[model samples]
Target: MAPSKKMTFSRRSFLKSSALASGGMIIGFNLFNACKPEAKLPVDLSALNYNDFNAFIKISEEGKVTIFSPNPEIGQGVKTSMPMIIAEELDVLWEDVYVVQAPLDTKNYTRQVAGGSQSIRFGWEPLRQTGATAKQMLVNAAAARWGVDASECSAKNGVITNVKGDKLGYGDVVLEAAGLEVPEDVTLKDPKDFTIIGQGKGNVDIDKIITGKPLYGLDYKEEGMLYATVLRPPAFGQILESFDDSEARALPGVVDVITIGEKVRAYNDSGKNSWTMPMSGTDKVVVIGKTTWDAMKGKKAIKAVWKTETALESSETHDKVLLDLLEGNKFNTRRQDGNVKHAFANADKVLERVYESPFLPHNCMEPMNFFANVSPEKVRLVGPVQTPEAAAQVVADLLERDLEDVSIDMTRMGGGFGRRLYGDFVYEAAEISNAIQKPIKLVSSREDDMTMGVYRPSSKYKISASIKNGKITGYHLKEASINGNMYGLIPNFFPAGAIENYQVDTANYKSNITTGAWRAPYTNFLASAEQSFFDELAEELGIDRVQMHMNLLDNVKNNPDANIEYSPERLQGVLQLATENSNWGKTEAGVFQGLSVYYCHNTHVAEVADITMEDGVPSVKRVTCAVDCGIVVNPFGAMNQIKGGVLDGIGHAMYADFGFVDGVPKSNNFDSYQMIRMGQTPQVDVYFIESDIDPTGLGEPTLPPIGAAVANAIYAATGNRINKQPLINNLEPKEKVLG
Candidate 1:
């Protein structure tokens, strides 16, 4: 591939710089500083023996290939799969490639985040180019040695050979390859030639994971590091009024207790230039001790009084306000495609429904935790962070140190989902360590993590559609939620551009309860609202649900809108594949089925649920999914993501929800907040669409449609239209009425 103009940092300059930095041994490139000119490495690059190659492919003298994965590995399997992409293009043996997690260096790496399913989508091409560029250098080296044209030579399995029979192993010419000038252009192997991309390669850390090796942040330990737990506000709207830590301090293992303070800002408070980083949460008291258990005990021993503001908001009030907004006709129009008023007036029948989704907590297997060692000279942190670059910035800003002085080492996350994307936990650890002048490990108990952590915002959707002669005439979606609003509701989201008379309106209710991006974010609830409406429309039109969606796709395909976002063909592809794979419409007598399709994160996914309730509770016996993410990078890994996404979505829709009463989270642990158990998890069968298009994001696309699929399946079984979420608690299954 002739280095696309998109690649400003050419491979030639990269290899030359690598050779100059390490005397022609290391093959690495630093795009961090190239992207951010302000953030430069403090070390003298000219004097160092080896420059840091943020994401590099190094060929050791023994022919072993090492590829550094720059993104954080939060169980999305990027740590292993990203390296496979590079190795596939490098034409090396999969067994010979070793993957290493790169450290947090903004000067050496850019976009070291794990959320938004962007890791694979972002790394696909650039990583392949890195490998292709390296392979070309090896081919050139071998060609020179044999005195043959480079075009006449080919490299495979780390061996280079010319048509004349001159051959050389990559190891035999390592020095020569490193010495050779990097080629300006290189060719990437076609997908048909790929040996690793679509293959089922086990995770590189599978051994460490299964053998209970120290990989997660909770497993991290350091000398002189004290364990800490924060006694945050009893509720979101409360703050630490006072605390008496005398009894706790006298405990045997209790080290010290420090208070975490916060400065609250209004929703419109963005004009100020003095703010470095927004406060993570309300102020709190943190107890430090020799061990985690000791810290837990000390926290219990401590007496603290929280200022539970009587006027503080609660979920009850937020829901009431949102319900009022949904009931009212006033709205802030986000987008309007045509004359919805005229279309509704001319319609044959009108149908309207209000759907509500509760706030959700990301119950990662391992609770929030981080280890930090802060001193005047330097600050170091190692933990499970999805956004390492953002975490480093928070540390550097908190310590008043340069970005280069802040070192962040990302550890394998027990689970992130979307909770680890925020650096609030990292900030807490750094602040505690800095204040105590000693290394510290900050941990949040399951209760604290569930109650105090950032949460998925609860949303209310008031959707109305007008039907004319078995076809949708007009559509209007009015969404109300807490915190900041969203923008992609109109032209970007599906069914919006497809419908001619479409209007999307939004409203926000400000609150002290902090909300952040959960997996799939707005799409999670939006899909539930929109897809359920489509099912309802299908029922109104006396047609099959899948066929109704197909008819709309046909309308979108034939009468295309000005700014259509999703591909009708891809959506149709997955829908048809899902039905075919799930044996849709042909199932056991007792089993009820529901189908839903969605497109998000550049991927299209259609899910079908085969459900049969047991004792008034739904049991998902099996889930069949059709995924189109351009190309499957790793078959098993991609399948696992879909499986996990399906299970996660089902778990949340069935029972996982958070409630706030008097500003304190009611569901603080598994007892109140339920997770989908293994016995309840369905057997997942996944199929991917074969295509030549580049790989897209798969981490979250499959999750959006699952809630609706399961809900619709429950409706099919019970004839109960459940408009609210957490169907286990919300849906009233009086009697089984299977159709």
Candidate 2:
């Protein structure tokens, strides 16, 4: 036994501007190689050891391997999986490995935030290396003590033993090994020999989540943090005429009332067809207070008026404005696949339909909030953010300080769904803090979160399919008018060369309403239109729904056209598994089930919806899903995401998720903007594909297809095609929607 010299080093993390903020890394596609999944080792725990990290793995003279993870634990369970990588290499019992979040630094940790579903995938290699390398170093230390060659010394279940059976617990060897420099290029476990990794593990933070621990941004509170609420414009394209904040400033707990104005260059095009971020609007009162409730109440008392220049917030204005834009009289052309005029010119059976989607609020359970303390010398920004690096950069620029002067501490996100990714809120917090010269937490009331947010832009799709005999040919999707293309990650991630005589065009019109990313971005809308249309086409061909989807996926997988990229194995498995699980061709009593499959976030998911009608209204009873996200770290967490996403899809697909008048969002609260209740939560069955294909994303992929599946089921139940969303509830068809 020897004395431990020292055991500590600062953690390393890479900080970069987010694509959601400035096109550094696109949301849907990989601008960074770090977002892709790495191949995983099989589950087998044979040869293992632990070395320099052995000190960190101290046993108190008892025994434990402290697996320090460089990634954050938001909801997805990397805090558990990262330790499993080390446990496999250390030959330690699962219960003995205590996982801890790594501290922040640039050189030590990998990409720390969770996004693009790359957590488990990117962590597979580096974490495994971290474990395996430590094991080898420990084995060397153990062999030296036993007077034996390293090869003759084997590690198993936290104990290193020589051929002669001389044993040393990991705790005993830590002190001697900490002095030796760790060797680079230490052998990593072979795919066949891996034990703990690639196996299903429970979430590391389950206790925290279940016992109502402070694991989310909403729970964060620090000394000297004040609360605040702002008055944003009621409608988009409106300007602040004037304000009377005399009453607001006099309110209890109200420290000051401040007014802000929208400044230019607050947002950049992140490059998805004029899809831009927001500039913190200065059209209202700001109530600074000792508590959130006080600040929010004070904001309501402020008297203000904003001039509605574009269109008054009215339902008729909404209808008239959207109808004129759908006539293809807009500026932004999101995507143009082929000569739509030429194709429509030669078409025989041109099936044309128009589908409308209302504006969507992100509706994260936790409201939007940010905390900032700004001064002339330094700036500190803290919040639950999807893009900490992006927020830091924005703060530095806005404060006119060096990038290093700004420090951002990212807290656990209650949910991103895409709303927390914006830097405007971060910018606003900084500005308010700078103006007041104090530490303040900018909080949004549920109503403010709805109104002030850059929502999922309202859109309408006009699709035309050219079907000829039993075998079909040409297809074209002409997206009518929308504010911003959600496919900011790629110009077109979908509707690519799978169809020969096809065209996918998008047109965006200017509106006072602001827009940003929602879950699955444009994919949810694409799936609703494309998959439902496919069902309609299949009905015309008199083909089985399962077989029809299989044929399409088969053609795409067999020859991906080399342009569009996705794992064929994953796509086929989702299709096959979902088909098998749902008993696709079987018929239920008064129920009809519809199916849809899609690929995104580097993962493939297929969903089948069981629909039933009661009292003339259709309801989703159950949804069975098959997902192949490469490797799932925490089975429970992944299932939670699948279940949550499925219900989220069902809620939006069946109800009016967004209520907008002119450019203003009408649904500001739960009463107006409905959410899926407990009664609506159907039985969800999620199946994971058996593979070691690295980790793909889980947060978003499950979302795109559920809406389409529900729509397809409605098609099966009624002779009417539900290509348009909200099911076009007027079943009697008293007066038809004139095209």
Candidate 3:
């Protein structure tokens, strides 16, 4: 099959074009091309015609528009929200606009990554400009035909009207517009004039998803493609030594057995450690067969020997190491303001607490899977991945092929809480295909997905505060974790500006176990610890929790810090909105409440959890949340993200637990791993702060606050200050609670 033609437009080279055989207009713009020095402006388009250009916007003779979305969709609703931004500024009817996922095009797109909840935030301005520019060109064409000044013509709902009341549809002038010179400047709609944005629009793929369409990597297949299942080391410190595959090869449908990872192992041993590279070890045994079942069975039949290069790590040992680091005096100071040592020495009162959390797996609904076909000419990769460009690069490097020879097609991901950000699975598929010189689909069972995962690091935090004469004078925080510490930007958030003598110190112990970003990353657990500590500090100071937080926010707002990364005004707004809507100080009988507020991912969120006792057990009944993520693109999709984040926060903090014993994962599947069920979900009420500011991240900001809210509420109902995660472990017995 011949590759499709793509024409990319930018502020520079806006009029550059090629001859096309059709009578329509297709427009596209490189989101980041404006900053490049290489883009030449005002290219001649007199020799060009319209025919076969396929890009962001496609206009038909019937006036229908198709906008291609360029970002990978990992259940963050970018697929729906991104195109909405274009259609809004293009002045097109929403019902007449169709959306399609654009294939990976690194040449024409930037920041295609899906993690960090930054898709909408980065695409806001560029997308609007593209749409508005196309609409302006259409209006210009209509004005020229009417022999009137372009400024005298107006466009609305894909139609252009002049001062004389002459009208022309976008489709009528699209072909002529294609030949016209691109305008250097275009007018964007004011927020108040927005008709499609901020309105509720259903997800474009909702129908396909509900009808069980093949949208995920696990559902993808190709003609003449084989299946592959890999056998990896059971423990982190172990590596593949040898494997006997004669019995496995004798199986009925088993095709072949092979070994991979020598090159990767050499790369890792070269003394330059790269966190972005695969962490699931470099040695693996692959079993290929005609079907998935045959491959899995052959893998089960193989006999493999492993060797350990380092001491096997256990959760108990990690616990001791983290606690010991906290108790010791040696640490790395992340941030410091004023004189913390003097403030602590001269304080009237001192309070301290330690909080701990276990490692967690993403446990996406669809297990890891990828399809690869490698040949001397080109490499084709299809799968669900959060970082498609990174995956393509890794595969290119692994196969020792040119980067341009590799192509990626991103399918809709079932779930990617940062786990899919790594391209280990993609590398495996490509490596196997390159070795066998055939197309193959690599599938991982649930057990494989869980045990061999880059998980959320287990961590511990010790927070201390000094109160002098009914006011907090000093604040200090110490962090200890596995592999890494909190991101450098986090120490400058919230309490940094609020306290005069504040200090933050961090320490970590390196282990063979692989750990990386999970959900909101460090903030997922850090927010819970800090918020819970603040609640206890308020109680010790004889002040109301809400008032205490408000006062602290005021301090930050009054005297801002140069290094502070959050907006005090925005944080205060969400806090006030959440408290007012949840009736913070007042609740009906049999109800107990808790509140928490946090800022991350360039967004602010506040939550209040309401709890009720059912049969002597504290049960979360509802949660109220207020979010300030700037202007919401799609209220319906935004609501879903907020609600899903809140529930996920509650579920993980309440039930999710993971551990390693003798370097092997303790839980291999959901039966062994604990998770909150459908019956345990709380009613989440979300409210958005009205604003015209550009949008920020929504997917991760709401999550950081919900766990803290639920934990505080549990304390209110049971009179127990839980300082650890998987709150079920710390909750008192039903008999003791009833007494």
Candidate 4:
């Protein structure tokens, strides 16, 4: 792995430093700070200030420091973790530091996104440099004031001390630091010196979250803001023909009724459409009312007509298409090595199996809501969105305003899981506000949120392996999905370089139903299928499952492919850790265990599932996971992420199911959609490998392997292979559906 770049800072000639109203210092730096105009500092030194950069630190006269976190916090703990990185280098007391969320600033910040678990991975070095530069400036100021060489002064815990034992608090030199030139270079502390980065810290928003304070988008309110409930088409292929709002208008607190979708289409037609634009079908009825309840009631009162514009898709039809495509010769080759046809034909034995997964909704607890106010002068938006920069741009395009004129304030999200990555709800709110020329908060009911989601694409994987002389000689993987195939990254992962004659082919059937990133994206299900297949392969070869994995890893390590994306050493470490901690081959009688290891989202994780008989059915009792994501920024937060990911993976694989019938979702609410309850949740124990490598992602990596581990455990206990999800359908044969 490449070491993190050593960042440098220098004084910009065009910009002038200014003092705060209370005469404190505010230091800010960005990679492109020299090219951009100076950011205007806020007058109040105590209040959180928005400056241009990844992040900035503020010093008050009372020796208190505030760090503004730039990225969105979608319950991933970046709001707390990112600021911790800054404070660690700033040499400040963790208790005296306060963290605040920064607003959207495209000109000042880059990669201000919260997807793919890249927040900390990308923020690691820049945030460290930000704090280190500020600390160096303070030290320089103190040295200059004391009439001593800067090299003789050292800073610790917000205080500067000289060689002679003279000391000064950061606050005492704040004004001097503000006027001094920024140091060109500062050395970062070694990993051994870190105190706050590795320590456990409570979430910055935990208090407010538990106390029911206003933080999420649903809790936001504005003066004279109207509540909106949109009535969309009931099915995927359907379009809104017309709606009569006579009864809706008569309802008390109903302000008005309007239609949107034409403007969105017009924007797309204008040739400015991009991937960031909303893929959710257009055409909907917006009911404006005084309260969310009134708007929802008004929506129910409206009578709407819908007409199908395309073929009404059904799950049975999708299943048939996917299976047929797998058998057909037409396919797009994703990866190819030696000839697989020749190897399979000459092999002594061949094993084949198909794994299937259905579409899944994100099921975010807060639903979808955004506050938008469109005036002739500017557009103001406040909500929980993962991609605020994209949301602002799309609204700007729809309203034909300058991007600079649109401002977005990101609120803490109840849950994102990749649903908020799209800006469909944001543009809808902007459209509604612009139509009425008033501020509006668009709220989606649980049903609406589930039915209108950009779901995880339903997919099937046909994996076949050829064996010769009791050794695996070839491997082939065929994938078929709705709208898309597995991302390009997965084809280059493990088992790719391990096999000599490897081949991967993919085919997709495009559908009107919106499908996009969901949590770990395709890896969420792919890992489960791939891991389960590996276990079966091990059994077919008459080798211990753990030993087989070690051998394959050894192959990759000895001779690696140029396209490989994972580290064999790291993966081997986690697998060993997890297996040892879980007592892989030494479980007590009546207890069956399965292991799975995977690398994704730049992190390596290994999971072991323990299962036992309950009421004559296999039950997951506990899950033990080992992770190697370089460094653990916050142990408590990292553990929470691992536990959550493991549970989410097991829940979806075991019970969560979604299907479409005649273009309509079969499960639109909790009553129909199954989720793992607290009682059914397994005990998850997580252990992290200690390393000096820079930190990687943790939010999504732990999810991929857990499903496979649980499925393999079930197979071990019941002697029934689960090739389909939800695993419940196969475990209970009566509930199974045939293509």
Candidate 5:
């Protein structure tokens, strides 16, 4: 349990490649790459190795099956669920087949990152195939031992049985089967006979989790491991100029204070700074200590110089900049259907609305941290990463080593929330490890985590509709401040020629706040703008919002009018159930109602929130959600995720906001950056549409609707739309704003 004392490492190698060795069984074989395709290769089986380890089964000499999952187990319960996929296929009890966070090895892991709510969805197919293939091989091995036909043998619960009732445990037969050539093109079990795939499987480690077992990135420990505190730039275009580490070096437990000059390469063609901090790769400050608190306390005394922004955007001037740009009317042609302008010009009545949103953050429970022991020849990285392959490349680049030398071990995450997608932190760890020539555990203080977090970008939506005789003939959308990465992916789905008489043009501008993927990314903001506008559009036409969406679904259900990639039937089903369950329009009193539907992560969801004014605030009394994520696996977990996501999204919309002063962020802690408490959670009702479709993702599917749903409700109550984000009383007002 003590950290390995292998000190042969003179210079930290950012990439560490070792052979596959665990529990006494070593399985290694053919790999397809630039080098070899038809050859059997050696691999490292250690807990954290960069070598190929496609083998799923690791049998102990005493007989226990361990399944290695290449994906990180962020708090979405994937540590429990992804293992269940292998267990279902391997026919082992959840406890019997232990799960280990997979190491970074490209040959063994495909789609190793656990982001975009893809842990379960991505592993579904391969895990199934793994189980079926293993079972088949075990059956074949048993049949040969019994001198019988393979077809007459059956495999179950890690055992192979014959017609005459001969049986053997999986471990007893693997050695024999390992020698035989694995059959190609093996058939899998039919859905009707899936004993565990579709059945309710609980979180395998619920007891450990509920009892406070050490199972998170924050809880990991290594002997002689030094904690590091990094000092980064406060804003864009900032650079380190000078520093004095003498006072820091004198502090208790202070090992070293490093001034690293991190440089990001500019594009050869454009020759622009790739980014400001992580993206731009500014040099950093490293404060080493025996403990996190000591390191942080000592970090303050380490004086350093930094350059202020040049030719840049500031938070105070960002709004004005976008407003000025809007007047210029420069927008990309996202979608164009019919003669939208002419139709709007000739319409009997026209409705227009504008909505605004503020910047956001992904405050994950486990602030970014990665444990690394890097060297120029090889490196070892152990952390929770969404993209293991990408992390591999990063370590290789940072250490200036061969890609094959880098090793990564993905641990279970306390919470990913899409924040783990960025591998920049991993780069820092590798850099510091290589710099100090010692293994280092790079950690971010809560302040560092919040202030330097890649924030969700803000935007404004301008929607216009042409209404003639109570029928929508044309629609137009002009969205501004669309600087988030979603802009790159959105146009591919909803570009020109998707809808009739429709025009969608978006203009992007810069802001002081940094941007990264949040839950549902653009959908989080898009739903709030698009859905709320649609709700108002339906009201103007005096039509039910559900019906209006259904009309749109009709267009996309068969042949999608927009180039959007979503199953219309699934989306419509969510709307169908939400309307039916909420007793739509069949209730009375001062209750405010709002409805919305959006699709993401291969799932569709519709939500209807019922609200009533409580103490001059729009408090949700109840919410009815209808979701169809294909066939449910662990239906209870699925439902729990839906319930949890709805509440999380609700809290984020109602209270979560990250502000800025000059170049630094304000409200950097939980005390100021509040989250939704249990007391605030409303009565929630969730319904999963009955279907035979394979299960879809649930982690991010429920978040996109909350902001729009709540905003719509507040509008119904006061008839004055609340356009901005963090609908709260906490703020630094420009015109001395009021709640």
Candidate 6:
């Protein structure tokens, strides 16, 4: 077979071409290239090797196989699990395979994003095919050398074998296979034959992480790099009026005090009707110094004045604005099923409840920081970012450099629920470096990162249902939120298609405080509110809580509505598993249980939380989770994700909330804004349904259900129906409440 035609590399493709050229035996994807699959290829190898392989799999003559992971590692274990899938299909031993994080290259790798729990869900097939292609090429090469039919040869454990028992190692035949043309298509290994995927494996960076080695963004260092810090406006809609930096400049080790102007965001009419990157950082003063401590002291010494813009929106007015809109006559209907008006009027019993959640901050453990070296000819950036492709584009535009002249390297993140998705920190570092004409590292203090936040918008929901003849006949939900509605109240969620009459209406109030995607996005709030309401309905009907959910699942199964997105059998699988594992409806004295199930990002999860009162506060004693994400790629990593998500959900529901006064955030540090401590963490047990289906996302699907489970358990423990978040103060001692 002859090699495929060579092609030139685009600016994006050239980033990874050099790495692929040195690493042998890359996969070819002419089939998916024309159709343009959502997950893209490796950097184009054609420019370096003159052969158009996708460039994901590589083998060296030293008996080593190197696989490139194409997603950002934000503590979700993609840095380990993705390579496990590829190595499984390639028939390589786990010990000999090494994983590498691919750089930002859009031409070869499509949709290099870390949010929505979509890394493995979208890359399963493409990565499997990449490995199988490499295996077939090696088998063919071995057969040709042995002068036998290709069907008589077999590959296993990185070795090629013939019918007569002759064997050749993958490293010995890798060079010969590299000369052959990549096969257009190849059969993937059956699930029963998988040796590396289903088995438990530790994170690739465990040794480095546990041994106090440098692997995160804050640990990154460059030659002749100065530390920089910026003082942003006190609040949103405020601008820099004046500053006295004489004291700051006079401090020892202080280099310069520069003023960064407010950025103007222009609407991009030439393309989609969306907002692009701003011109620069917020209106603030930048303090450049020799060390991080020096920058911190200098920043504190500087004095500045700010003036608020009266015309802009304020958080202080959002609550009243949202409350007014919820009752107003005008609303945009997102989904409507049967006649809700007629069913509500004719129902025997009507149930209505209101739920409110406050805006929350990401509070990533490492704070926000990035290192950049910008020159007139080229720009280089290294940082912890969720979307590297978007960051590269923003850096090029901000520095007035060509796309080909910019390069980005991804680092391990301390934590990024969804905070790193934006390129704000990366752009800030690059701009400061460009202005100073030197390499620099920008670090944000805990207070700085907390105040200048793009938060999870506050939201309110009014959910009502009409029950007639012991069956839910009508369902209506009205949501009002700040910024924009994250979830559009689709009909695919629970009780939407299950009921005969369903309708959803929504309204949005403008906000000056920046807002963006949070973990699990809108499902985090919607699932909690809807599930808690369902528990109330079940209590009113005198039915088992688990049985109530099971009945609704049966409804969706029997009706077969086109609006249903999840399979009824999959939902039932997790629910039944959770019920059996937690021994639902049979709890010991002093222990109350809550059950909830949800499906999102192509994954279904059911969680049961056991709660008890400890010193007048709700204490989560234990939690059991049942997840059905098709197939478990890495059992250890998947379990870790579920545990982490459940813990995060519990913390946010029980203790985390942020408030605003006038236009400034009231909670700026951990003293005011609380986080989950190790003492509060509950014991978690995870179980997975055995299946042969393709893998789905596990990072976020387990999060949404945990909140409802905890909230429902709290209601069971106490007679109060808590509709608002931060349930800390809401729960009082039973003795005090009775008095």
Question: Judged by lDDT, which candidate is best?
Answer: 4
Residue-wise lDDT of candidate 3 within 58-166, one digit each (tens)?
Answer: 7765778887777888889999999899899889999989988766764434577888989899888778877888888888989989999999999899899998888
Scored by lDDT, model 4 comes in at 0.86
lDDT of 1 by residue, 4-34 (tens): 2223345433434233233334565543333
Candidate 5 residue lDDT tens string, 102-161? 566665445666777776776666555555555666678778888899989887777778
TM-score of 4: 0.96
The lDDT values for all models are 0.80, 0.65, 0.84, 0.86, 0.69, 0.79
lDDT of 6 by residue, 207-255 (tens): 9999979889999998789999999887777878889999999999999
Candidate 1: where are CA atoms >4 Å away?
1-9, 12-24, 30-53, 262-282, 485-491, 733-739
lDDT of 6 at 423: 73
**How many angstroms is residue 587 displaced in model 5 relative to the true structure, after the best TM-score fit?**
3.6
lDDT agreement of model 3 with the native? 0.84
| Top candidate (TM-score) | 4
lDDT of model number 6:
0.79
Q: How many backbone clashes does candidate 5 have?
A: 31
Provide backbone clash counts, one per model.
2, 12, 5, 0, 31, 3
- Cα deviation at 690, candidate 3, in Å, is 0.8
Model 6: CA > 4 A from native:
1-55, 262-282, 311-316, 732-739
Runs off by more than 4 Å, candidate 3: 1-10, 13-19, 34-55, 266-274, 485-489, 560-562
Q: Which of 4 and 5 is the better model by TM-score?
A: 4
* Pairs of colliding residues, candidate 3: 20-49, 20-50, 20-51, 21-51, 22-51
- Which residue pairs come into collision in candidate 6? 27-54, 40-110, 41-108
